[model samples]
Target: MSAAPESPAERQAIDRLFNPRSIALVGATERSIWSIAANDNLRRFDFKGSIHYVNPKGGTIFGAPAATSCAAVGAPIDAALLMVPEAKMIDVFADLEAAGVGGAVILSAGFAELGENGAERQRAVAAAAKGAGIRILGPNCLGFANFVAGAPIWTTPLRRPMADARVAIVSQSGAIASQLEQFAYQQRVGVTHMISTGNEADITIADAIDYLARQPEPRAIALFLESVRDPARFAAAVQAATAAGKPVVLLKVGTSEATARAAQAHTGSLVGDDRIFDALCRKLGLSRVHSLEELIVTADLFARLGPVECEGLALTAMSGGMCEIMTDQADAEGIAIPTLADGTLKRLREALPPFATPANPLDITGAAMLQPDLIPTALAALASDASVGALGFVFDAPLKDDARGFARSFIRHIGEGFKAAGKPCVMMSHTFSAVNGEAREMTDSAGVIYSGGGVRHGVSALGHLAAHHAWRRRAAAAADNVPAAAGTTNAARPNGERDVLDYLATAGVPVIPARLARSADEAVAIALALEANVVLKIASPDIAHKTEVGGVALNLRGEAAVRNAFDTMLARVREAAPAARIDGIVVAPMRQGGVELFVGTMNDPQWGPAIAVGLGGIWVEALKDTSLRLLPIGEQDALDMLAELRGTKLLDGFRGAPAADRQALARAIVAIGQAALALGPDLVSLEINPLLVDGARVEALDGLTEWKESE
Candidate 1:
């Protein structure tokens, strides 16, 4: 029996359809093409639940008695399938609402796809369903299936048995979802559940994921999203799935600007900023696939093979040419295949002929195909060796009758041997001839992940699988004990340089101390009091980039120099932003430090707040060498962000220069994240450019923050 549903309303809806006492098929007809196909599909599957057909002009459908309307069913309906015309969808929904329908699968297209008039009708349907507390699947969709219960409520008929499967397929495109289902059926791979979220008007992909996460059968979820409506909610769902030990493989299509615009016009969904979405996915541990085929193949492997334990890989092929090709591809893709040890090589040579070379990608010669047991023996030897964690098998077909059988036997024996020895193996099969049933059975039964197409595809899948494993390991190890604040703080205000510096100091970000002076004598006195070479700047909240306005003068060595520079800077500021209000000349002691860095934090309305750190000074924008991390980051995360910078060489003692204090830099970034979290939406932007780093300290030379009024 299927497990009890956990999501209250969602469970009620699923249970009502899968194990319902009765179901009413609205818009059912003897002449409708969908009805005829659906009726035949139901009979073929031998569904045990009570089925009632409802059609206004119905006589009978597939030998089942018909009802003039949903109310004519004369019993409480659990779920109703509305395969009606677009114009009549709302009215039929109203009738179902009046009849107290529990849930509905709307297979109508006119609601959202037919322009304004249809959109109004779609709204009406949604309003009626919400008012009646009825859960809806879609107004323009292919519907869903609950495999365990033999519940195939989809518009298209499916007759395959629901094998115990671990992967759940969810897609925004109906065609992609159907393709995945067909692919799985052809591979003899079972599907736990499949859902096509068409025109996500009411229920969304995130909601489906949140609900499906409660199911125990799906060990992984394969998602194909054309657009994302709620980025934060999607991030949260992905995080929840990760916490539950279930990986999510996602294929996000239509990322280009033109494609995004097309998606918006097609579904009325905000395509969202691509960069922010990509960053969110990385932060939340969602493995991204680039194509539909890759998504299906990777998901299937992850579901069947489970997680790979180690990064070490060993490639074994019968031909030297294939080995060379595999090696070059693996190197280009960053797949590390360690060289075999001397002892391992010696043992392999003893097992095979003296001419056999036992390198990383062991080429035991094409003659091994004649030996039949040679391939499995070599695999067994490698499996026993501690040097190899995983193995790759490349098969080249020969023009012999037993060639197919030999390949089949080799796959089965090696697959069982690897499992027994606690190792994983993937196979690459290249042949112009069509793959027969015997070859497929051997590949599947042996638990070998087969790459039936191209060598690059097989390598790419292994590389992705390895990368995912590494990502999970890093994420797990980086879990820190930083407590989140109860509420965000507010720091939005138009303040001069002094006030901005004070706020940064209060947030635990180190900044240079300075005093504001109204006149040249005051500036001279402040510079003299510090007893060091000073930097002078106009302290105006209106002039954020003071250098552009000629308001900044560095290396004011004495009182005379300070006085002269202050007067000249004041006149330049007045000339630059003539209408702007001038604050005063600010003087601060200057200290030589290594490396200029820029660190900033901003609150994105869609994906929450994020912090970025990069090479500072004029090249910050031009080079754009930066790394971003989600807000509320811990010290470790801050350090990782800094380490990821391409300009990290500047911090690592470049050209005989002393290395900058990365620890202090990390602390400053973490502080920035804390300030962002505390400031909430009231804070617009917080930037500290040209932050100086010395032996064990870092100082923010300049700081600025923009604010928004609170509701």
Candidate 2:
């Protein structure tokens, strides 16, 4: 279900899978584990749709009448869940498809994970599924669940389904999906859908996300993924979800070598570069979580309070110790806990005793325990503060019912007050197990989010929410102001150093003032005309690393010195790299006393044009500290990347050295991004090493450009 219509074939197939009117269990039985579990869970969950059992032996299953085959049943089946063996899977699918089944979820293993033979069988199954216009979920998958439809197709032990589902968990690993479900239920978080896109031979994770984006029941989406099969469709789905006002939280593994190899062996998925995936996530406004804890916690926050739109947070507590703990956690996570506005302080002073403090992490003291009204009054004042975008109330509670009730009363009253103001509020307990049914009910009724895990988890959730809010705004602004890269009408020819410099200069990246000279006398004349100490380097596309090839000379002060250096540089280049296609020598006036930096771009096949910035000079490789972001980024993004570097103090003039012009450097970075956008795919890669940065000036001292192809 896309905002735009899905292809007629695909749309009908997805509809049949998620909203099946009639389901036929292909390998229905009384004894097999998966079959028994499926039948028992369906009956327990009380699926409203028509259910049919098909067994070759013609035995009834779970009191449902059995049919010998799809034709014997003699009706159109919407979906079939097959628990058959690998050898019989293809034939079973063919029977269902010929019987006009719309979708199939095959729970058989031995496909892809078993190597080449299994891979070949999986391909044959996919071809048969497509030929019959059937959308298949897996040839080796654990099943899916649609809680809203009361269709728990998953074969697992059951808890009573949640009444009001809000978050959808879509994962590639069935075991992980089940683990997440159990964890969510244990934490009292409601889930709308649990989909495991195992193997994804036909229907992909992208398709599932796209379909879920149009579902009204899910307020947020949590994706547990290894890789994306279709990047374009995946990106579009993310955009659609954002536009539809649903947040997408993602947990992607495969960053390490062992994990990547494991992923390939397990699911036969290509673990693409994780760094590129990270950049893509940032570009798409996806909140990427690294662990299972983060995934559940982040999604719970989104489901409980909706999207967080504020940048600052206010923390209120009854105990000063709890407040201190929360403040420490917030600071450790880099979450902003701003001071209360003057008016907010005045209001708090009137409500609380003189011993109570009126600041962020405001400690209302034990006085609030006696005067219950003080809690709501303080919360209202803090929510009304101009600087506070969100609010959190943390209180200490024991595991006893009485303590839980007291905590509940405080939360219910605070939630009621903040509900009218319509800002997000979080009710957290000092201990994870202390938050009981009463506290959770307060959240459900009052629209306040409850984080049962202590101060650290609560603050971490708030930190992630606030960061996403800020990034979304920046992404939106960039989208409106910047144009996307256009289609290439013509290819670019391979460029030499002069061509690279000329192209960069036109794009506002300040290249050093230089001239190409074929002769030593010509190079000396160009250096003397500039009337400054000059550097000469052999200009050749083949000799990209000039210094490594002995093609560079520095600090020639006189005409004779420049002429001698030019001849020596040519001779050295010939001796070092005799086969290089030398394109003459470039002589430029020397720029001194500045920090060496690098700015680069690559038209990433998956993410598209991205810019990278780092400390340059010869140690660029040795000191691999750098930051990257997708192209068409603003000046602020460029500046933020610079500030993120570990060596930022070097740019700030460490130990009495002159501070480099960071603004100038940021502009140069932006210009590189702009050039990348303008050139599109034709500009394969561009690198400007030793981009010198002095006070209020930046220059590209040397560069290399790789083209798409010659016309």
Candidate 3:
């Protein structure tokens, strides 16, 4: 709606398009399900706008005289739903433009989603819409609905509104939009807007998010994404939403790494499409979930509770078994279930039956079943604990005809307990179930936030709440300390391993000292100066893995051994890769025993510069256990990335070895990322393999850089 990064006037125009006062259904017919559903939804939603039916062949449609075209309507039409054939779009747009239609929803298929020819056709249609001064949503998509405004342009069976809806759903697939709406309503989670951005030829998901970010209705946004169409707009829109204090939750598919991993470095092997998106999410403060149910539950909880502000959850249940189940799941989800303070326990003990205990995940015992008021008393005491950020009670909401007898009084007291506590609290189901209207009314009357996802999904949602809160603080702090990535312009172009070390040395990154030896005599002379065992390596910009080509000879001492190895290694490399351009041998002292860390940077086609850090050597490819983040990261972000690695424990002096200096290592990782960015846009990958973290020392043992070929 607000196509942000667009002018203010343009944003207002798009906003008007989404909330149009009048509509024209161009292909309305009795035989088409789409047309029937569209009309039915408008009526059901009580949309109080003028609706016009138009067809190429004018006739009676929807019990009204249908206009032959938009021009024949003889009224200022704000928006038109074009249900005509793809081939007829050119002519139809002409008619709409002449009639001064401001926006068009192209429901016709056979556009960009079909590939080359379809893409070409879509381009033409986009041009036509632009020439007509109209904004378009999609040529292949289910239309949108604005619940707050009572507007329904959607062409699917619509559910009744949830009066106080606060979450908005945006999806790439029309079908997924429908599914999300159905699920959201089923969970008793109301939605303010539902938009399907299928084949986003004109208005993309970024435009939708940017528009929604300005609204006061939706407190949290849920995104079902297949891919990103505009990275810059997407980032800006998410930032706007974050600034608005609205959390964005994303559920995406497709994790193919084949294309991103096609390079001559280890970094490429670890970079995937989804990993890049994951890195972007971390940078943007988005809560990412994996399942459809998680997507809704997390967003719903985010909307209802906002951020938890603290890191712990206090839970209660009637049965010991249920309490155990919730605790186990909480532990699994990494949710902190803090123990109640002494004062909280004393108050709980005073109010509870003698046999009952006072603990976090406390079992209230069946005594509360008869004396229902005891439940709220226990809850109030639990909520008083300083360790509890938020509290939850596992009470399954009743279905139809079940909200009678003791249940009514029980729910009322639970509501009283929630109010008296004055904390963010929720009533969760013991098992996954839907909230019927009667149950919904019962909870709403008590002012209780409820989730039918029950224990598993509900606990996971709490975990997300805490995690997102923590991320926001970290992201805020990180913003202040991000180091600038300006590289020296006069620095020599790094063509090989030796040149890369020279470049890194300028940035305070310690590198293994080395010298170029053009001949056997030069190799022996370089070895004599080192005063220790030296290693000889072929220095060629064209060669990457030196071991495979026999271009590396490690731990050689004395003039005889150094001279023989340099001459023999060159011969071997020539036989293996004859066309490679050799820049002579690199002779350096051979040091032993250190933690091998792999730090690499990649220029992603979609996410831009990013870096990966993990255990180096064979473990890099064999374990494939690495952590990634978008580049230009602060030292704390780099530290967080290292902490996320599975083999991170090895850095703490494993098996009686020297413990690596993590702060020093983190700075090194950040420096490498900055260096990679400074190499400019032509860089494909910059790698520091086996970074050699020995004791308190960290140095770059070897370095490599790959560049894009000049076209």
Candidate 4:
């Protein structure tokens, strides 16, 4: 089977499944209590669409008339929910297709996710659906349901009715998907769509996201993915979401090697290459959450508050000790809580009592909670200040009667005030059980994300959210133009040193002039023509590490020095590598520069071509500093690549030395990436070690390339 082309009309038709005019439940039966429960939920949620049940058993399901099959259904069916066994799914899909069904959600298992035989069966099902021009959601999936449309295709029965909100969840795991639904229900958070992309035999999480992005309801998307089958497609979907102003929060399940292996074994999907996946996510501007709880909380915040445009945050707590702890947390997470400006400080000082300190993370005495509106007043003053980007409130449980009322009133007032001011605010309290029922209700109704257990978790969550916002804005502004492709050429070079020079020069990398000589007389003539101190080294493709075998002799001043070093180097190399074939001597002018650098390219087994840049010379191993980026990177991205290196400070005039030419380095890196991308995996590795970088110039001192056997 060939890959299918994107069809805009077909995608639109697929969208109707989430908001169908009428639905037919094929193979619906009383014995399938799960299906019956879903039907009951539709009615309970006051679904406006018509529901048709097709069961040969001929009984009423949730008081709806049951048709024997799709042929007997009199009304037009927009979508069909199939709950039959795997063997009967193909026929059911065919019937639905004949009925002009726009989409079908298969609730059965035993497809590609099961094993080899199941994979073949899944292929056959996909082929049949494609031939009929029907969009099939799943063969081994839990099915999807839109809470906004009151669609009742979900496998698990929803205990609570759906609330209207801006968060949509899509998960590969059925259990996780159900858990998200329940979590939202418990928190009274609104959900637009909940999907479990089981097996992903045809429709994937990316496809679902693309569909959801068109909906005007959802402001954010939360994803739970064990593996990404098509990274390019996923990245495109994420980009689309970002363009639509919908933030995507991802909970990636497989972190360790064991977990990755287990995911593959369980689902027949690859999951181990986390580095490439992370790079893809970062490039595409996706928020990565570590845990399930964090996923919901962050989604809730993003959905309710929208994007916050603050440079730094202001933290306030009832206890001074808690403020100190939060300081450490903020420092470790790289969250900036700058000192209060003079004007803002004066306003805060005036608003609070005499003992209150006007600083970032202002710690009011515990007695302040006794005042009915003290916390909210402080938050309002801080949020109104232009210097504050966000506000954090911390306190123990509101125990006193007045304190409890004050907590409820303050949360309600602050929530409304933040909404009006368009600022983000978070609340932290250890008095989870002490708050009155009314106060708890106020907290929930206001949509405030709270952490009662620990300060670190709360601070970390806020810091991550803030960083994500910052990174997204930056990535959005970064240049996205694709770099021009570099053309290939063949150059004549009989020896290793000449070949290195030829290749580097062809790629616009400056290199020292070099020549190959069969005898010492030829080496002397070449050195005279170069008119500088020359270096001579034994040139042999078979010799990988030349210095180890005494094959290199540097800085030959004249004829006598060149002749003696040439003879000694060749003899030592021949003795060291007896079986190695030998090439004669390579003579080159000595190169001098400000700093030494290494740039190399390697083909990753999973991510294809990638480039690496690092500090060179003796400190290479000691520093172990390097930065890697996927190949075919743009020139601006190349600059970013260089800046990511840990030793980048050295290039920027460290220790009062002249700064190296960053633009020159970026150009060289881009050139290397173009070459690697063109040659592909056939060129195994390319290295330019000790590349000299001066004030505004760069030169490749030495380089090597390994080629693969022709196919």
- Stretches of candidate 2 off by over 4 Å are 1-5, 256-272, 318-332, 342-357, 396-400, 403-405, 420-422, 434-439, 442-447, 494-496, 549-551, 575-579, 632-636, 647-667, 677-684, 707-711
Count of clashing residue pairs in every prediction: 3, 0, 0, 1
**Pairs that clash in candidate 1:** 488-678, 489-678, 489-679
Ranking the candidates on TM-score from highest down gives 3, 2, 1, 4
1 or 2, which is superior by TM-score? 2
For residues 1-711, could you state the per-residue lDDT of candidate 1 as single tens digits? 012223687657655643445567788877777777666665666667778899888687768778899987878888888888876776776677677777787877877777898778888888877777677777788777767666666777675555557778888877789898877665545688888878766666876786667677778889999877766567667777777767888988665353233222101122234644566666777778787766766776667666767666787777888789889988886787777777777777888877787787778786675675676667777766675666777773222327347556666665664565567777765432234445555666777656553456556666666767777777777665443632665535636778778777888889888888999999989999999999998888777778899988988788789989988998888998998778798889887757888877765555666677888777676777777766667777777777777788778887877887777888887886776577666766677777777657788888777665456
The Cα local distance difference test for each model comes to 0.72, 0.78, 0.86, 0.71
**Residue 502's C-alpha lDDT in candidate 2?**
81
Off by over 4 Å in 1: 1-7, 18-23, 94-100, 113-120, 157-164, 185-189, 230-233, 254-272, 310-391, 396-404, 429-436, 451-455, 490-494, 589-593, 709-711
Model 2 root-mean-square deviation: 4.4
Each prediction's TM-score versus the true structure: 0.85, 0.90, 0.93, 0.83
Superposed on all Cα atoms, model 1 deviates from the true structure by an RMSD in Å of 5.2
Candidate 1: lDDT over CA atoms?
0.72
Q: Give per-residue lDDT, candidate 4, residue 404.
A: 41
Question: Candidate 2: lDDT of 220?
Answer: 87
